[model samples]
Target: MHFPVSGVDVFPLIPPAVAFAVSSVTACAGTSGAFLLLPFMVSVLGFTSPAVSPTNFIYNIVAIPGGLARYIREGRMAWPLTWVIILGTLPGVFAGAWIRICYLSDLKAFKLFVGLVLLYLGIRLLYESAGRYLKTREQTIALEKKFQERMRKIKSKTSTHLAAGIPAEAVVKNRLVSLRKIEYDFWGETFSFNTITIFILALVVGLVGGIYGIGGGTIIAPFCVSILGLPVYTVAGAALAGTFLTSIAGVVFYVVLAFTPLGMHNAFSPDWFLGVLFGFGGFWGTYCGACMQKFLPERLIRGVLGILVTILAASYVIQFLII
Candidate 1:
C-alpha cells in the first residue's frame, strides 16, 4: 500500500502489527508506545515528514482510551494527578507544536533532537532500575517475601470465598487531593507527591512530547516513579490520561496548521488513515497490557523498557554518525 502523504510503500498490515506488539509492552509503563512507534514510522516505514509527529499523536488519541478505561475500572486512576498533568501539559503542548512547525522541520535536526531525548529517557530509566536492584537489595527482598506471604493468604481466602462469588474490589484508593499535594494508597502504603512539582514536570514533558509526538506519558510516568517516589501502579493511569488529553490538543493543532501556508511546506497534516490503522491494533494491545500490568513486577517492566529504549536511541545516534 502506498500512502501518498507519507510517500511510503508497504503492506497495510505492517503498521498495526507493529503497533500491537509495541503497545502491548509499553502500555504497562503508561506509554502509548508512540516513542517507539515514531522510530518505526521514520526508519522502517519511511515516514520522516514533520507531519509524522502529529500522526503519531493521533495514534495516542486512539490507543490510550482502552488502557485508560482499564485503569479507571481498576480504580487506579489518580484524578488529582490527571488534572494537574492536563492543566500543565496543555499549554506547553501548544507551544511545542508551534516550535515544531516553525523551527525544527529539518529532518536531520529533528532526528538529532529525538535521539537526544530518547537517550535521556533510556539512561534515566536504566539508572533508576539499577538503583532499585543495588541500593535497595535488602528492602526489596523483604518486600518480596512479604508480598509472597500476602498473596498466599489472599489465595487461601479467595478459595474459601469462591462459593460466595463476590468480586474483589480495587486495591488503589485515593486518600487526599489538594492544590499543594496529592496522596493515594495502594496495597498497604500511602504515596504522596507535590502537585506543583508534577505540574512543572508535566509542562516540560508536554513540550518534549509535542515535538516528539509521544504525548508526554513516556517521560512523565518514569519521572513520577523514579523521582517522585510514586509507585508505577498509581502513576500509570494519570500518565496515560495526560497523554491522551495532550494528544487530542496536538492533533487539533496540526490539523489547523495544515490549513495555513506554513503547513503545506512541511506536511504538517497527519495521514489519518494510516494513524487509525495503527490505533486499531493499539487499542486491543493497550487494553491487554493494562489488564496484565498489576501482575507484573514493576522493576522488571522498567528494566525492559530501559533496555529497549537505549537500543533504539543508540541505533538512531549511530545512523546519524554514519550519515
Candidate 2:
C-alpha cells in the first residue's frame, strides 16, 4: 500500500505487526516504542519527513492508553510524578516541535548530539544494572525467589481464581508531594525523588522527544530507574503517562504549526491512517506487556531496558558516522 503523505509502499499489516512487537517489549520499560518505531519508519518504510515526528506522536497518543489504563487498573499510577513530568515536558515539547521544523529538518549534527545523549543514558542504565547485580546479589536473588514462589502458587489449579501475575502488593501509594520532593510507596518500600530535578530532566527529555517524536518516555524511564533510584515497577506507569500527555500536546502543536507561516517549509502534520494502524497494534502489545511486567524480576527488566537502549544508541551513532 502506498501512503502518499509518507511516500512509502509496503504491506499495511507490517506497521501494526512491527508496532505490536516493539511496544510489547518496550512497554515493559515504560516506553511506547516510538523511538524504535521512528527508525523503522525512516530506514525501513522510508518515511523521512518533518511530519514523521508528529506521526510518531500520533502512535504514542494511540498506543499508550492501553498500558496506561493497565497501570491505573493495577494501582501503579504515580499521580504526583506524572503531573510534574507533564507540566515540565509540555512546554519543552512545543519548543522542540518548532526547532525540528525550523532548524533540525535536515541537520546531520543533530543526530550526533542525540546519539551521544542516548549513549550516555544507555551506559548509565547498563552500569546501574550491573551494579545492582554485583552489589545486591543475595537480596535480589531472594526477592526473585520469593516472587517465583508466589507465581507458582498463583499458577496452581487451586489458586487459579486469583488475579493473574500482578499481586495486590504491587500497588503504588503516594506518600508525600511538595515542590522540592515527592514520595511514593510500592510493595512495602518507599521511593522518593527531588521534584525540581525530575522536572528539569523531563523538560530536556521533552525537547528531544518533540524533535524525535518519542514523547520523552524512552529517555525519562531509564533516568528515573538508574538515576533517581526508583524501582522499575513504580516508575513505569508515570513514565508512560508522561509520554502520553506530552505526545498529545506534541501532535496538536505540529498540526497547528503546519498551517502557520513558521511551518510553511515543513510537512508537520502526521499521516493519520498510518499512525492509526501502528497504534492499533501497539495497543494490544502494551496491554499485554504491562500485564506481564510484575511477574518478572526488576533486574531482568533493567537488563532488557539497558540492552534496548544500548542497541538503539549504537544504531544512531553508526548512522551519524555513515551520514
Candidate 3:
C-alpha cells in the first residue's frame, strides 16, 4: 500500500503490529518507544530520512495518550511536576526541531548525533541506579521486611503512616504543588522535592525529547527517581502526563513547521501513514505494558531498561565512529 505524504509504501498490519509490541513494553516503563522505533524505521523499513524524526514524534502524539490516561485514572499523576516540565520543555522542543530540519538531514549524521545523546542518557540512568538507587532500595527492603515481621507477630495491620501521625485523609490530599518545593503524601510517606530545580531539569529533558522524537518521560522518569529521590511508583503517573502533553505540542509544532514556508531543504512534516501505523500498534502495546508494570519487580524493570539504553548508546557511538 502507498502512503500519500512521504510516498512510503505501507505494509498492512505489519508496521502497526510491530509498533504495538514495541510501544507496549516500553510505555509501561514510561517510554513511547520512539527511540526503538526510529531505528526500526531507518534500518529495518528503510525510512532512512530526516523525516523519520517527525514521523516518530507522530507516534508519540497518538501512542502516548493511552498511558497518560491510565496514569490520570489512577490518581497518581503529579500535576505540578507535569506543568513545570511542560513549561520548560515546550520551547526547547521548537529549537530542537528546527535544528533537525536545518542541519541534520542526513540519516547517518543524525544517527551519530542521536546515538551520542541516547548514549549519555542511558549511561546517566545506569550511574544513578548504581550509585544511589541500590542503597535506597536496600533501605526500603529492610524497612519493609521489619514491618512485615511486626505485622506477622501481632497481626495488627492498620495502614502504615510512613510519615508519623499523618492521617489517612491527608494522604488523599495532593498537597504538594509549589514553585519552591513540592510535598506530597503517598503510601503513608510524605515526600518533598525542589520545584525550581525540577523546572530547570524539565526544560533540558524537553529539548532532548523534542530533538530525539521521544517524549520527555524517558528523561524525566530517571530525574524524578535518581536525582529528586522520589519513589518511582509515585512519580510515574506525573511523568507520563507531562510527556503526553509535551508531545502533543511537539507534534503540532512539527506539523506546523511542514506547512510553514521554511527554507530548509528537507522541511519538517510527518509520514501520516507510518505514524498512524505505529500508533495503532502502540495503543495496545501501551495498554498491556501498563498492566504488566504493576506485576513486574522494580529492580528487574530498571535492570532491563538500563541494559537496553546502554547497549543502544554503545552501539550508536560505536557505529558513528566505525562508519
TM-scores of all predicted structures:
0.91, 0.90, 0.85
- The sequence of per-residue lDDT tens digits that candidate 1 reaches over residues 136-210 is 544344434545565567678786421211113535678888888888766566778898999998899889888
Candidate 1 clashing pairs? Answer: none
lDDT of 3 by residue, 1-323 (tens): 77666666767788888888887777666777777878778767777766777788778777877776765655556667777777877887778777777777777788887788777667766665563565765533543344445444443455543221211232223676766888876655666788888888887878787777776667788777666666555566667666677777777887777776772445467787788888878877876766565444445556667778788878877887898
As for lDDT, the candidate ahead, 1 or 3, is 1
Query: In order, what lDDT does every prediction score?
Result: 0.82, 0.81, 0.69
* Candidate 1: stretches off by over 4 Å: 131-147, 150-170
Better candidate by lDDT, 2 or 3: 2
Q: Give the least accurate 10-residue stretch of model 3, judged by summed lDDT.
A: 163-172
Q: Give the clashing pairs for model 3.
A: 20-281, 24-285, 162-188
Candidate 1 clashes: the total is 0
Which model scores highest in TM-score?
Answer: 1
Go through the candidates in order and give the clash count of each.
0, 0, 3
Candidate 2 residue 251 Cα shift, in angstroms, is 0.7
RMSD of each: 3.7, 2.9, 5.3
